[model samples]
Every structure is written in structure tokens, then in C-alpha cells.
Target: MRTHYRFGHEWQVQARPDAVRALLEDVAGYGAWWPGLRVLADASTPSRRAARLEVRAPLGYRIRFTLTESSVDRHELRALLRGDLEGWCMWRVVATRGGSRVVFAQEVEARSRLLRLASPLLHHRLAGQHAALLGAAADGMRRALADGEGAPGQRVGAP
Candidate 1:
């Protein structure tokens, strides 16, 4: 029998909540800041509130996901997986005294029986990869903030 699991982590960045949100919305820059993954495609809706992104893992495994139900006021974003894996990935940003706290979580199930059987091993690897990627994002955000590279008028705290 296969089991489903949830993995999540929280990261603190020296950037305001709105700035962090904007940085995330910058699809083109994700590959620059994000550690391992590479963006394959970025399509935004007319409103630009929703987007579809195709990405590949560090090892070059491709995954396409759609981000929908975006709510900036709430500082949260949701994504549905469309390729390779089938599930949901979400990010919730909360404003903090100095900057912001970001929570990243994902719920996924294999699309095939073979993948399901391999989940135990893949889950462990994925968890580690996720942590590293989050760390990289945090580091990149910090560096970008230090250099004042984000949206204009948005000031980030000192590192």
C-alpha cells in the first residue's frame, strides 16, 4: 500500500510581506533566485493574477504546474500540478515586525502505480530537495534585498 504525506517549512526573509509577494510573482526571476529548479514556461492570464509555469527539478525532471485562486490581500498563493506529479503546492506569506515569514507546503500523489510504489524513497529525497530549495530562496531573497534589487519603493531590512 502507498501512503500520502505532507511536507512543509517556514522561512524568514528580510523583506516586507508585499515585497516578498511581488518577488514570488516575478516568474522570470524565479530561476535566478530559486536554487535548483529551472523555469520552462511562464504564461500569465490577462489579469496577471494567475499563471502557469513549467519547471524542471534539479535533475532535469520536468513538472508543469498552474497557479490559481490567487489572493494578494491575503498574501497567499495556490498551485495545482499538471504534469509528472498531481497535487497542490501553496505558499502563505505573513508580515512580521522586521520582515516577513513564508510558509511553503505541498501535497502530492504519484500519477502512476510505479511512482506510488517508489514514494517512500522519493519522499525522502523530495523533502531534502525542498528544504534546500527553500534555503536557497531565502538566501537569494536576502542577497537581493541587500542589493535593493526588488520592486522600486519597497525597502528591505538590513541583513
Candidate 2:
């Protein structure tokens, strides 16, 4: 049986909602602020984009997922995933006093047999690794935005 996982995170970013939204909308630029992720995007219009992502998990695993980003509004991004993972992910960003409050939510089923078999035993470890990764990504985003990176008209981070 496949193991289904639901992960969510709430992060505080040092940027306004618009700035955060612009960063979030630029899906191709995520590697600059997100750790262990490399994204390749194919798009003809703003409403939808097809992307392939390669992620290096902390446990020495490489996860490859192909997804289609369906919508990106002023403060939200929604996507459907396939390949190694199957399900959906969403992000919501709201303006706060000194920055933005962001919510990242994902519900996915492990399609890899190794992961499915080991999930029950390594659940805690997996969760811990994911938490650490998300924490680091949050810190990276804070620094990137604070330094005026990832925002439109601002300099982009190195490849």
C-alpha cells in the first residue's frame, strides 16, 4: 500500500504580500530560495505552467516530480503533482505587520515502493527532515527578500 503524507508549514517572510506574491509566482526562480530543489518550467501562458522538479531529500533520496501549476492569484499558488509523487500542493501568503504570513500545504502519496515500504518505520525521521528543510527554506526566503532578491525589478539570485 502507498503511504500518504500531508505536510503543512506556516512561515514568516520579511516582505510585503505583493513582494511575496511576485516571488511565489515566479516558479522557475524557486531554486534561489528553496534548498535542494531544481525546477524546469514550460509555459505558454500565465494561468498554467508545466514543470519538472528534482528534489534532494535529507535522507539521501532523489525525488523527481512532474507537476502542472494551475493557478496563481494575488496570494496563492496551486499545483497538481504526478510522477514520483501524486497529489496537490498549495501556498498562501498574507500580508502581516512587518512581513508576510505564508502557508504551504501539501497532500501526497508516495509512489516509490521503497518509500512506501519504509514509511511506517521512518515516519518520524522523515517528518523531522522535512521540518528542518522547511525551516531552512524559510530562513533563505527571509534573507532573499530582505536583500531585494526574487522581487520583480530586483536582481535575481545566482543559479
Candidate 3:
């Protein structure tokens, strides 16, 4: 059986909603701000792309997945995943008193033999690792936005 996982995270950034949405909408641009993320194939539109991501925790590995569906509009963003992992991930961005609040959620089934086999015993550990990875990314985002790195005019298509 495949190992299924679900997780959610919320973080606030001191950036405008449009700025945050612009940053998140550009999947190919992730490698510029998000750590350990690499896009393998850039989609012509803002709606889809194929990527390889590696996370280093107590356990480390890489997975290749195609983001077959994506939507980035005024209020939210979402992506459907396939390949080494299969499921859906989404983000909702809202304006807050100080900045923007981003809510992110994801559900996926592990397709790799190693992950699927060890998941029963290490699922919690895996989840923790995922959370930590996201936490780091959030921190990176705060810095990038403050530095005006993810602003408009960045090259966002095809790596």
C-alpha cells in the first residue's frame, strides 16, 4: 500500500497580498527563493510545471513530481501533483492587519519504494521533517520579500 500523508502550515509575511501571490504564482522562480527546490520543466503558463525537490532532515532524499494543475488568482493558489508523489496542495493568501497570512495544505501518497516501506514506522518523523522544511522556506521568504527579491521583473518561465 502507498503511504499517504497530510499536513498544513500557516505563516504571516510582512508583504502585500499581491506581492506574495506573485511570488507563489511563479513556480519556476521557486529555485531563486525557496531552498532545495528545482524545476525540471517549466510550463508555458503559470498553471503547471515539473519539478524535483530535495529536503535534508534526519532523512534525506529527492522526489520528482509534475505539478499538473495550478491556479493563482487574487485570493488563492493550488497545485495538483503527480509522479513520485500523487495528491494536491493548496495555498490561501489573505490580507491581515500587519501583512498577508498564508495557509498551506498538502496531501500526497509516497510512491517511492523506500518511503512507502518505511512510512508505517516513520510517518510522524516524516511529517515533522516536512514541517521543518516549510518553516525554513517561510523564513527564507520573509528575507527575500524584505530584500525585494521576489518582486516583479524576475524571470519566471522555464529554467
Candidate 4:
């Protein structure tokens, strides 16, 4: 069974690249805009560039990982993950016709022995859940950007 998953989710928005980058870099602001999403600081992990974030989906499962290396620039926010999952995740922003295109890409391998072993049976379920989560995030961002307030708690965009 394959234990690694590569997910690429893309969307185009009327917002500019900088606007989208700002929203993506504000991980702490995610819960406010993204429905069923929660970002909590992981005090156990230390980082100067950004907070060590533990993200939880509405279903109560937490994505356990720490950013070992990361960088945020005008067009991209990329991070290398380590913990229960090991891999890299990136949010790439680029100018499009009238707005910007945002692509979220992640390549991760299950570090947990049990999860790795169960990949064959559980992979589809895992992918479906992540897709739903990403879809909600995209919808939330679209609303927040449309409202001109993408910051956390600025406006309720929960589904």
C-alpha cells in the first residue's frame, strides 16, 4: 500500500496575489475565516518565523506536525513538516488575468506505523476528508476576500 499522498488544490480568486498571500500567511486567522478549521499554537515547538501551529478539522482530528523549515514571501508560503506527518506543504500565488491563482500543494507521508499500514483501506477516506476541508477553506477565503476583511474575527464566513 502507498503511504504517501500528494494533494494539489487550486483556485482562482478576484483578489490580488498580495491579498491572497496575506491571508495564507495568517495561519492563526484561519479558524475565523475557514469553517470547521482551527489553528492553535503549539508551544512545545519553537519557531521565530511563525508560530508552531496545530490544525484541527471540524471532525476533531488534529494534524500533528511542526514546521522544521519555512519561508513566506510575496508569492509563496512554504513549509517543511515533521511529526506524525513528514513532508512539505506550500501555498503558491501568481497573477492571473484579472486576479490571482492560488495553489495549495502538499506531499506527506504517514509517520505513524499503524496509519502507514492501513493506507490501502483508509487512503480514500483520508483524501475525501482533506478535500472537504480544503473546499471549505477556499469558500471561506473567497467570502472574506469579497468582504474586504480576510483577517480573523473580522467577519464571520463560516459555512
C-alpha lDDT of all candidate models, in order: 0.65, 0.76, 0.74, 0.73
Q: Tens digit of lDDT per residue, candidate 4, span 6-123?
A: 9999997777676787787666566678876555563323553344555565456666666543776767888887776789989998888767788999999988676687677878
- What clash pairs does model 3 have? none
Residue 55 accuracy (lDDT) in model 1: 50
Clashing pairs in 4: none
Candidate 1 lDDT tens digits, 1-159 = 443656687878766777787777676567677666566656567665444555545645555555543444467877666545677777888877767888888887666454566667677775565576667777877776656543334654423
Q: Order of all candidates by lDDT, from best down to worst?
A: 2, 3, 4, 1
Q: How many steric overlaps are in each model, in order? A: 0, 0, 0, 0
lDDT measured at residue 113 in model 4 versus the true structure, 0 to 100: 72
Better of 1 and 4 by TM-score: 4
Best by TM-score: 2
lDDT of 1: 0.65
RMSD of 1: 3.9
Order the candidates by TM-score, highest first.
2, 3, 4, 1
> What TM-score does each of the candidates earn?
0.74, 0.84, 0.83, 0.77
Better model by TM-score: candidate 3 vs candidate 4: 3
Which residue window of length 10 is worst by lDDT in model 3? Answer: 150-159
* Candidate 3 residue lDDT tens string, 44-133: 454354344444454667767777546666788888887777899998888887778888999999987878887888888888878887
Give model 4's TM-score versus the native structure: 0.77
TM-score of 2: 0.84
Window of ten residues with lowest summed lDDT in model 4: 150-159
